[model samples]
Target: MTEILLLNGEPLHTVTPQLLRATSYAHFSSLQVRDGKVDGLDLHFERLDRSTRELFGRSLEAAQIRAVLQAGLAHTDGNASFRLTVLDTDLLLRIEPPIAPSTTPVRLQPIQHQRALPHLKHTGTFDLIYFGRRAQEAGYDDAVFHTAAGEISEASIWNICFARGPEIVFPAAPILNGIRQQVLQRGLAAYETSPVLVSELASFDAAYLTNSIDPALPVAAIGEVTYAPHPESVRTIAAAYASQAAQPI
Candidate 1:
């Protein structure tokens, strides 16, 4: 499980202070590359393109991104966790060991916070990391962010969803539209996008978080409310995600 770093299409050997500072103004998307293919590959490209346009006043071509991803995969076994970051117009590809979906349910501590640019997956993650560490220090798995008015937005680095019977509810807040969430919503039979209040969490049958790495991770508890295990729901969600066709890079 060797890690490979590439800037543009060339190898990145060292990280100077200037390079580190330049990368702070970047936005990135991560995906698990299995067998040199990626599920929701188009969505990842769209995310990077949209973020680049909005953040840098320029568009990044999907073909260019695909080329960099392919270059990075060529150095690996074609199975790894890959991240494509846009530092202005430059592309930074990081390939690392693949991550499997979590089997254990996560416990989240609700925190009052919001990301600077909620729509884009930008590099300003100081609050996210800080709150996550505080939650871990307090014996929780991670932190779930909520607006000052108590509207649940998202978790530290994942999108949050709640289940009520056969319906999947996504909180209608200013948060990043995660690629996995978009794919799951498309495959789901019944789903809703609405404002979810933290106080109303107890009414839900189950809770879970989704990201590029973990598609459907059950939430055992959030704040003081606890949810019973819902393995069937998780299986259904995973099936929907797995049913998607993986496109070659």
Candidate 2:
């Protein structure tokens, strides 16, 4: 679980003096590397490419990016979490032991804040972390965000999904379109995107959260509206996600 940081192909320490005051204008992706294999590696690469273009006004060479990821992963084994960051032209890859989110059901607190550029996975360290900690202190597992109009967008680090009988529904507002969500969309038979109002949490049968590392985690409650964890739907989506073959990066 030791820290392994790499810039481009060269190794760097976590406390590198230059990184201490680094600007926050960066795009990144968080993925799980198990036994040197990665799930949705292609989608992860696509995300980096899209963000690089949108944020930096240029494209990152694919072979170069792959080489950098390979270089960083050389120092790790077993399950681990990897975060690839692009700050200007510098490609930063940090690897640590895998940190899985809670498997148990979680409660979410609604926060009325929306990201400026919801599509790109840019550096949102301050507001997301602050609000997450605030929610934790207030006895919630995490915070879900909504627009001023009460349209649910996403969570601090996860995408929200709703179960309406046998179908799956996602919030139609702007979101990061997470890699895990993409994989699920490919595997699930019935899913649609619609406006999920924050004030209308009780209308759904069940809810769940998805991110890069975890497949599907059931939601227990949001604010005061409690939901009985729907294990069948969660298992179906989880199995479909697990069936996705991991590729070497």
Candidate 3:
């Protein structure tokens, strides 16, 4: 078992069978940790606050969580994945191993399944994972989900970004607004914040996915349909977030 987790500063739990099962999805947010710090921690906190209200019709107090974590966490390992969970009456925190992100851009097979509460990050996301794994299995690298409305969304784990010639677009709210999107917007790097279609994607120059974990990885190909990344733009934007993945929160 790949058991690696650091809670606060102590080794609280792991995915090991000897420990508890991973089957809960409350108002929560997962942080990308590298070395000894959390990436976009402020953003994660913001997301945790917003996601809690959006997902559970309640709000999570940052002060409370920070206090709990700072006082109880015990990190006894190296880099790991950390999750903060909050419920109506309870708050739980866990740390685990980092997820594997594709090193290169990925192709896509359109999956037109946009469910309710798409804007709110749902805990259960197997279909998304299945798409990614399937892409990798088929010798591709990623999967972009489309909808009757056109380009419904992309899964960047945190947020999805698409390139259409001179613009970097993202699906509007009701699809996914993840914290990363907010950050990108702050950087004034986001454009076309509206519903997108698969056909429109082809009309564009290129596309890629972004998140706390992966930051930015160009879209090498799109399904059986493939396109190349704009070397200059991809490099400049990617450079902005290259260090973010490992930046100290």
**TM-scores, all models, native as reference:** 0.96, 0.93, 0.75
Question: Which of the two candidates, 2 or 3, achieves a greater TM-score against the reference?
Answer: 2
Misplaced by over 4 Å in model 3 are 1-25, 54-57, 68-73, 76-78, 97-101, 130-140, 156-158, 239-249
lDDT of 2 by residue, 88-173 (tens): 78888888888776678889999998887888888866888989999999999999999999999999989999987767899998
Candidate 2 pairs with clashing backbones: none
Provide the lowest-lDDT 10-residue window in model 1: 230-239
Model 1 agreement with the true structure over 1-249: per-residue lDDT tens digits: 677899998999997787798878999999998899988899998988888889889989999999999899888888999988898867888989999988799999999999998998988889899999999999999999999889999999999999887678999989999999998987887689999999999999899899988888889999899999766676767677777788899
lDDT of 3: 0.60
- Assess the local accuracy of residue 248 in candidate 2 as a C-alpha lDDT between 0 and 100: 86
Poorest 10 consecutive residues by lDDT, candidate 3? 14-23
Top candidate (lDDT): 1
The TM-score that candidate 2 achieves is 0.93
Question: Which residue pairs in candidate 1 have backbone atoms (N, alpha carbon, C) closer than 3 angstroms, thus clashing?
Answer: none
Error of 2 at 158 (Å): 0.7
